[model samples]
Target: MTPLHRVGSALAIAVALSLVTACTAPAPTPSPTPTIDDSAANTPPPTPAESVAPAGGSDPTCETIIPAATVEDFESLGWSAEQDDFRVGATIIDGGLQCVWADHAGPATDHVQIFGWAPIEQDAAYDAQDNLVGEGWVREDQPDGVYITENPETTISTDENGYGMTYLFGDGWVKVADTKQGLLLVVWGD
Candidate 1:
């Protein structure tokens, strides 16, 4: 062949070689999953400034929680003890007794909650223990007994005159007192 024909053949061969190389190239493999670091995997979630759990599940009553309405009844909750937000009676929730809590009850204004029967912790020793008493729950009425005068969250009810009003236990969600009932004398009174 002439020199020009030789150059043309070389160019054609180069193009054909490139096309063949591209068509037969192997496909790319997928990247492996990245391994998770131990520290990050084991780290606990940070708690917020404040959190609230609502009430739900079983019916909550006073007799089940506090045997009597006397001041002593309040102590059973162990509220005075110090601890985090989840102390025994801080929020007073128990699943075993049929009680449950909803962390996000609602907006700060609304007191929506998850209320249920608070369960009594099981103990092999106390086989027949505390069946008479139950969880300190908030129902809309007089919970079969007098209201204990503990728990800063506990409120006494009042009318326009700021006088105490009667609590008909079972009202659904009763008497969250805000005003002073004649200097606390009438708080929990009829």
Candidate 2:
């Protein structure tokens, strides 16, 4: 009799739970997005903050730059001992002077052009004795203009016409930087 009563109680509880579950409804699912007619044809586009800049834009200084030249120095652009008829040379451009030299061709007149990197004070040129000859500087004290230590001093001055038009060598118009680096630095591409 006791066992039969216990089974009857369990059946009653189960029936009650089943009835409750059947009456309750499941929760509704959420919608993916809202549907609305914005009608914002007259509204202007939102302007982004000035801090957001375009791509590929970097600081100019970060663009593979060489140092500025200083006085009493030579920035050896294409340093070489000897090649062929085309030896190597150094150009010096400080405040008032511009000069360059090559093998068998001491510091001569201002170079027609120097296209590579040249930094002042940091770059050094040496005499035969390995003494400090010139430090890189745009405004050097070479008042005598460009001179090569060959048979005679080969020189070019601002006073000379067509100095910057015809390249003494290479492919650009022969120009010189105004009291600074050579023409290669001052001018850019076509």
How many residue pairs clash in all the candidates, one count each? 22, 23
Q: Write the per-residue lDDT of candidate 2 for residues 42-154, one digit (tens) a residue.
A: 23322333212234743212111111331112223332222112111343323212232222244443333222222223223223112212222112223322221211123
Q: Worst lDDT window (10 residues) for model 1?
A: 78-87
Q: Which parts of model 1 are misplaced by more than 4 Å? A: 34-190
How far is 97's C-alpha from truth in model 2 (Å)? 21
* CA displacement after TM-score superposition, residue 126 of candidate 1 (Å): 33
Model 2 misplaced stretches (Cα beyond 4 Å): 1-114, 120-152, 156-190
Model 1 agreement with the true structure over 1-190: per-residue lDDT tens digits: 9999999999999999999999999989996432212232123322322111223533323222211221132233221111112112323323312111112332332211111222333341122112211333322223332232222244354334433322111112112112222112111211
